[model samples]
Target chain A: MKSLSLKRLLVTSALLLWSLTSLASSQFTGPSRDANGNVVPTPKGEQCVEPTADMRANHMKYLLHKRDLTMYDGIRTKQHSIVACIDCHATPNEDGKIVRIHDDSNQHFCASCHAVASVKLDCFECHADRPVEAFSDADYDPVQQLDEALAHSDKPHALMNRKVQ
Target chain B: MSHLDQETDMKNTAKSSAPNKIDQYRRRFLGGSVAAVAGVAIAPGVFLQTVNAKPADQEVTANNRWGLLIDTTKCASGCSDCVSACNKEHGLREIHGPETDAQWIRKVTLKNKSTGHTINLPMMCQHCEKPPCVDVCPTGASFRRVDGIVLVDKHICIGCRYCMMACPYKARSFIHETLTDQLPHAPRGKGTVESCTLCVHKVDRGDGNTACAEACSHGAILFGDLNDRSSEISRRLATTGGRELRAELGLNLGVRYQGL
Candidate 1:
């Protein structure tokens, strides 16, 4: 009778464990999609450098290894670069706004999974979250450019005349 | 076999083996030549492409010692173009005053008390061969690259400020507040010491020039491989000569000043 009761307890605990994992898995909504139902676009290439499952499991390891190589050895390969990840993953929303990495919403690629996993991402604090082109040259004032050009120009008078023309 | 028969047998074996050995050597030579030809055919394009710029996969080696030659006489007084260029390139903004602000590069005006003669030059991390900062740092965060670029590895930097104290030029700066939107190439944050990276990103990209040197309209700043005898910096240094700041310290600085 004691053995039978122990079996019952084991069964119940196994069921509970199975339910708990399913519940947790259900909550994780992976990558988000836009209003048009389009997934994140891989701009540079057709797909990721590595397979989806491998990248999901070992992206951090790849990034960490690449970071050391870049920081110490100056090996700037795009294969496992954070810049490449940001460029590809940080897609614009329905409103065409690229969400910041630290945003509360699940729109940001790195932040979405990190928020669910309860991992604090401080990379965006120092590194740029958005792609280089996201910050457009439109904000760069022409007057300021001309001023800088003249200031640094060996023949300032010649440059000024060219700008005036 | 008898002694004479054994001798004849040995002679026969040697004669036969000699041709086989020669044939084996000939085959090896032909295979090697083919491989060498293929290597030469494939290597030149790759080598020429990476002549100025290093390939992304390649590690920077001591073969190239990057440096700058700043002609102080050509550096105009009150012109802070180089400073602005550096700030823009590294995304360093002036949030605080001079005491607290992170100045990677600054315009230093030196006036001789005796003659009243003044000189203006941009001062920055000397990129010393034997950096005092590297020596004093307990964490091994302050390091010099194989290519002679001195750097602070923020990953390991404990914010000790020992390097700052050890530095003779006062080149390093500690971030007091959290920073945002830093350049992808130049990742800086609060509680870590940073200085001029010598536009390492550009160097890696094969631009072979720094923002400050590129920005200087007066052509005062020249950047090149100090080790390369053909490089402009080396040629100029060899002919006209340049001096390091605090030469008595024997740091063997990468950056040199002309007309100091």
Candidate 2:
């Protein structure tokens, strides 16, 4: 009877592992289709979410807060939501790419779809979309910030909506 | 009071003093700031330490007084011209809730939970004179212009959120990804915090005039040289009872809020 129980458990674990792998593979396939059932490689377009080095760093931290929230898949509860929108949405290169030599906010990815749908878009509703030079705090690495947040979350070190001078 | 004697006396005093009374106070205040950041109360009259040997070139008003005036009373909550214009002028991604997205300007609909009175107001950077963000920036990447425009130097930013913590209005955001260039004005980069600058690049050119300020169908946002007596911003200051947020902090905020 014990041998039979062990056999059942092993079979169930194998099925779970198999299903997880299958889902991961499929997520990258859809939302990017070519005319003839081919996979579209450049879904993000020539432009991407554009943040300055500093703002991107901060955004990286902000992204962490939303890490668990970005599962975009509608079917799975754990599926992330926030995608590559931040890329090329904030600051763009002079040619509309993001780089050290150029930065601009008057560029974005919404027009592609909005034009097709003929929908007038409200920009500020979703994006702060400002230059990197506007804020007093646009100069920190968010990955480093993760450490701070972690530190702050610890006992005797927490700060929540705290005021600074 | 001969020049050489006075200079010598000043040096002696400097050598004798540990720090300026303000500096000592600021240190205590900075220490308390940590506590305050930890949700503790700070004793009154404390301030952040001034940047040592910092060039005065960064001084605002000494160069210019950049400011914004929003007339909430005239705001038509349902109309979103400013929002649309902002998108048109600055290419952006999908619309996001107030809690996310690097939005420089946004209309927040607030309903008084107890009173059931709802009010919608456009919000952006306050541009405080005593900006907490400036004090909290570890790299001093965040700074104010001589014209009172607060901005971040993206080149120098390390993406730390000290300034994010310093902001009282929750008016800042960090960039998250790389970008594609399509528009000349869309600011796209990676790793930096940002907010509205009253359209410095556009306003400086004497053309763009802030997209939201010009797009408001109801004249809710008014932009002008606060220094000019004839400017609409100055006129409103004289006639309107607009108030600043946390006014008691003495930050000399550039943005003014008037309830409709």
Candidate 3:
């Protein structure tokens, strides 16, 4: 009878764990969508450097790695750059105005994902979200162009004036 | 066999069966990888630059000693153009007045005690070679860059006013209040001591002139590489010997004042 009761307790605990996991899974949804049921943002490039699954799982880790590399080592590869991420992700809406990440209403790319995950984004507290220069239609990859120009050109400041297509 | 040798052997085998479709794909992959490795190996300079944190063009070296030559004779009294320009550049416009406001550069009028003559000059973080501020800082946040530009790296500054106390010029200022709408280039925060960076951002961007020098209508401020003898400031300094404030200290200030 004792052995039977112990087995029943084990079964009850398993059921409880299953219910909790189901409840947690149900609460924790994927990326949030807009009112029209479409994903809020459509980033400009064909796709990111990494696959969607990898990016979803490890985007912050990639960003942090890039940040350390750029900050300490100055290894500014075009891929995995926060600047590039902002260039692609921080697009203007139908009204032609770009929403900042600080806004309470989730509109900005970083803010949208962060708000869903309940992660506090403090990068914008010191760093600017928007790109300094307004990119034209011709300038698809300004960061890469700038990097190349900086590499070749002796006058780094002059490159700022030159329009790269 | 070594891993690289084994990999090369595999590639050679893959290349031998080049006519086969799957082997052709494998050979192509190996060839592309080999080419990529060769490319990295062939361009050592480019690879080194790619690995470096500082951009290739933005190299701050000991050879280029950046400094400012202030022509006090040309600096007109009551004209705060240089001060205003610096304030505007760094977005130090949040006017709490001189008592609390962060002053990156300031216009000072110095009077000769017995000579009955006064000279106007723009005083700032002197960018000393042997800065006392740097020596006193426990966190080593107050530092002189490679190009003789003194800056407080706010990231490591623990709000300890030792640097401010050590600074002979009283150039450093502690942010007393929370800041908002800071300029993108100059990131200033409260509880951090900041001083003139000599516009290191502008220097890094290869902007030859500082805001103060550019803004000075009277041509009082001259900014250039002091180490380069051919530089305009160096030529001027050579012609007219400049004075360092508290020359007794032997700090070897980057900022020099003529007709002081």
Candidate 4:
């Protein structure tokens, strides 16, 4: 009788768990849509694309205005980099870091994108080809800079014990 | 009643079964797991961000100095109140073309290729404790205010833009094409490199806070002395999950980025 009771309890618990999980799963997943409507894990890999008509429209507008066309009306510089703005902005290279905001190469930002679509982005005329110019930090201490530099250098020269050969 | 009496009559019917070692072990394991789960669920909520339960105006100390806590999770999309506020206060929209001269603060959106996630970040000067603009300045004119605001002394600015090269945020802008570009909205003089001052000119009169912070509809922008724990900026930094940009640089900037 005890063995029978144990088997009944296990079966009941298992059924309860399975039912609860199925209920939760069904509740979370809303109606699934078409191939182009949402992201699909393609055989090539999990491909990411701007999915909807609205999204494509939005990205297209951004692309038009923010296109990294270096030599536009307000370019303050005589020289421009042939490298496309899309080169650095859309994807991070091997270093796995975003283009530092100061990098002139980072033409892929939405603001930059918007500026391209809009007329006369004033800042870029001064900035597009040059380095990022911004405000100076106020709190640097000369004392700490040297200390940090030494500490940052290769492991205190590994405490080299020199033998006068 | 039958079941109650059966329990009470344990003295007569209590069959002393052999010690069910495996069952006992199973029961102990279940009990232990229940306790462990209870600890996990409750411990984090109570411990995390709880110290920030004090009034918004509580005072902060060193390491506690002024900083912003931009909650990325809470930031909403397609909102531009912060931009409008900046332009309105700085008088950019009135003349309104792209030449709306004062772009001290602006917003940018980025797509994380690995995740296909779209994140919007409101960009501003980091106001490094040890600012690169100050470090590279040959004239020593780009000085830091004791209160942690960085500024260009109009009297001394040469517009060389060396400080701009040193800044990582691309926050600086030179008044180029001022003859053609200065919008009737806010006419800026040529030859001065300018970026967000955090509204220092207005903050001096004690009239307005940073225009951007006041205008942010979503509270993405915050301003205050990190030294004062009670300051809005300080309190937010303490309890919020804000991480500084290039924190490894140890520049210790005054500004903080939110919702990346």
Q: What fnat does each of the candidate structures reach?
A: 0.46, 0.00, 0.03, 0.00
Write candidate 2's Cα lDDT for A1-165 as tens digits.
879757644543453453355346557674332222322123234633332322212233334333312111001111111233433233443344432221122224333223323346433333333334322231222223335655766553323332221
Residue-wise C-alpha lDDT for candidate 1, range B110-155, written one tens digit per residue: 9999999999999999999999999999988898887899999897
Over the stretch A9-79, how does candidate 1's per-residue lDDT look in tens digits? 56444544543553455455443333322333324457888765446444665677677678766889887
Q: Tens digits of per-residue lDDT for model 3 on A40-71? A: 45577888888764464446656765554333
**How big is the positional error of residue B240 in model 4, measured in Å on the Cα after superposition?**
2.3
Ranking by lDDT: 1, 3, 2, 4
Worst 10 residues of 1 chain A by lDDT: A33-42
- Alpha carbon deviation, residue A5, candidate 2 (Å): 72
Rank candidates, DockQ, best first: 1, 3, 2, 4
Off by over 4 Å in 3: A1-88, A133-165, B1-58
Per-prediction TM-score, chain A only?
0.58, 0.23, 0.57, 0.20
C-alpha positional error of residue B126 in candidate 1 after TM-score superposition, expressed in Å: 0.6
lDDT of 3 by residue, B29-140 (tens): 6765885687588776443222112363333445567899988899998898777678767767433457677888888888989997998888899999999999999986
Candidate 4 or 1, higher lDDT? 1
> What are the TM-scores, per candidate, against the unseen true structure?
0.74, 0.47, 0.65, 0.43
lDDT of 2: 0.53
Identify the superior model by DockQ, candidate 3 or candidate 4.
Answer: 3
